[model samples]
Target: MTERFASLMERKLPMLDRLAVITARDQYVRKVLIPMFSDEALDSEVRTAFQSGAGGYIYQVDTLNTAELKLILQEYSWADIIEGEPQLFTQVFHVVQHSPDEAFRAEVLAEIGPYAERGEIDGQEYALMYDRVELAAGRQQLYGSQLECLNGQFDVHDLKDPEGVDARRASMGMQPLQDYLEQGRALYGPC
Candidate 1:
């Protein structure tokens, strides 16, 4: 990921929760990650998984173990059941309000910078990181107004307005992470 994009994400969304869901079908493998974004359904899964004592929010599975998941992917032709590079997946959703406090921003930058520097994340991933931060910040803005307090401050107007929020949610729901990653893999091959 470009330094510019990383900087943006740090400036926007400082607090984030990352969830990685792994599934396998036959010989094909996939990993779905929720990149600091929130959706009711996704949140519920995370919460339940956590409450049920799943540690670290990472789900790992063998291709031979999840026959149903593999079958589902095959049905959509999103992946071929073959040994190959593991695909990275993530879904971005739900905007929440966030504070631009210097300390908070610094902490976020510290956490993400190393990964970007190592090439573990690319420009697109950086962009998605920023997008999730913006969405969260937007939600925080709404909450602030409802509470009659301005705890979290953000200047991105698109996320603060109702129309913008609806638009953002719609866009997020339009594509599943599996589909998005499949398309990207097809276009770019193993990134």
Candidate 2:
């Protein structure tokens, strides 16, 4: 890496560290907390503790991370982040994904499309964020990357042109819809 690239990478380490911890906790919520809540026999006290503790952690961390990321994005663009690999900016994507600021996410979504097309950012990441933005606007997602868990069942959010969703996902370097849903099911429960 060039000196500048190395310096930028070093600067991203703290954000990456935060993303790693938040992701592990998110996985725990999906893999453990959700299932525990689904169980008809789960103890009320245990469920309440996990709900307030784990759920609150995700909320708090995402809030802080989102605020930091918004300032970072204001100072940088996709061009500034491009390095040897598209994943150099994965932390940015994850932060935007978790951000509650729909307007900011939408702005980043627009800014990243060209980068994804140029292969400077991961297309799958772009697709995922695009789906998130679209869904937040109460519109159908072009790529069915966003999933929801209602009750004990998991499924893709409303998708546009469902019949050709796999084709759209493929163009974005994503797995087929069924495979994506199945993977989410593996982590989050039955689809």
Candidate 3:
């Protein structure tokens, strides 16, 4: 299944790449871009139409045909996309959902600590932490203060590999704290 998904992704690379460019240009789509254009669903022709600038994209499923391929890509619901990536999206969605106003601020707080300790968090691993915090925050699954403290201890040190850091940070907003710690600990850990 992974291989098939990978192959499909390869085939849809052009469309995905184009969609990414469009999404980046249009901040409105930034949140929903991942769900709408995940590697799994890219094979659907409807996705292709929207990615290619067909008619007009709609946020509503009724407007988008699970069967038809002509409908233009429309708006996206952050909730809907988060539903798709329950593990990660749920976390982010919940953080924003329950707290409504304080989500992003909380995120900054939660991330600051770990970031300080480790110096960085790779995109993928951070996604995991984001999801966890989102779930905790949204569902009240965990103590908010605990999360805040944990994130606070993180001390983002100088990037040892400036070149690599610049490359990844340029592409993605930030690196995962786990990755940074793993690398740093491996290099600097007591022998």
Candidate 4:
């Protein structure tokens, strides 16, 4: 890591480390742990245990992490947490993006604009959240970064202007909408 990155991380090590732990549990439950339990080959009883136990754990952590992250955002700007270490943006953004509060997400979306402009955070990250906020508000998304699963097929959410979407996405360093949808389909198959 760069010197600034190391310094910032050390100063905020406790918060950042805790975020890492939360992310690990979050991803594990959704990815590896849940899948292990849901395997059709597994006994139903074991699956039930995983569902009750791990599922509860996910809810508990999500609530706790959301509260903690909200407090952190109240205390610090995104630049304070992410200016030196661009990578740290992922940790903070993951929490903000997954937050159940649409209002909070919208607030964070506004907060991120200047940082994205200054190149402190990835523009794609900003674009993703922008699309999410727009979709939540029943407005058309500009960058085509948000996708929806409609009738078991994943497709980009409605765009503000279909003709300008590719240019907007490119401005944010994102690929064409078609390429993004194709990649998602390739990786996750139709859902």
Q: Superposing all C-alpha atoms, what RMSD in Å does each candidate have to the true structure?
A: 17.8, 4.2, 18.2, 4.5
TM-score (all chains, Cα) for each model: 0.22, 0.75, 0.18, 0.77
> Candidate 3's C-alpha lDDT?
0.37
Better of 1 and 4 by TM-score: 4
lDDT of each: 0.32, 0.73, 0.37, 0.76
Ranking by TM-score: 4, 2, 1, 3
Ranking of models by lDDT: 4, 2, 3, 1
lDDT of 3 by residue, 1-191 (tens): 79976775575555345434333333344346534543343545665555445223423321222112111112333222222233433233223322223444354436443542453433443433443454545542111111221232322332234435445443444444456555544432211
After superposition, which runs of candidate 3 have C-alpha atoms over 4 Å from their true positions?
A: 1-26, 42-44, 54-173, 176-191
lDDT of model 1, residue 121: 38
Q: Give the Cα-based TM-score of candidate 2 against the true structure.
A: 0.75
The digit string of per-residue lDDT tens for model 1 on 127-181 reads 3445445444553432111221123211223335554544443343333333443
Least well predicted 10-residue stretch by lDDT in candidate 4: 182-191
Q: Per-residue lDDT for 1-191 in model 4, tens only?
A: 59876787677877677667766755665676555654656666776676678767777766677788777766676777776667878767876776678898999889888888998788898988988998899898898877776776668868888998889989889998899988776644444
> Which candidate do you rate higher for lDDT, 2 or 4?
4
Return the lDDT, model 1, position 108.
42
Cα lDDT tens digits for candidate 2, 30-106: 56656665454556676566656766777776677677666655665566555544555785577678778899889
Model 2: which residue pairs collide? Answer: none
Clashes of 4: 0
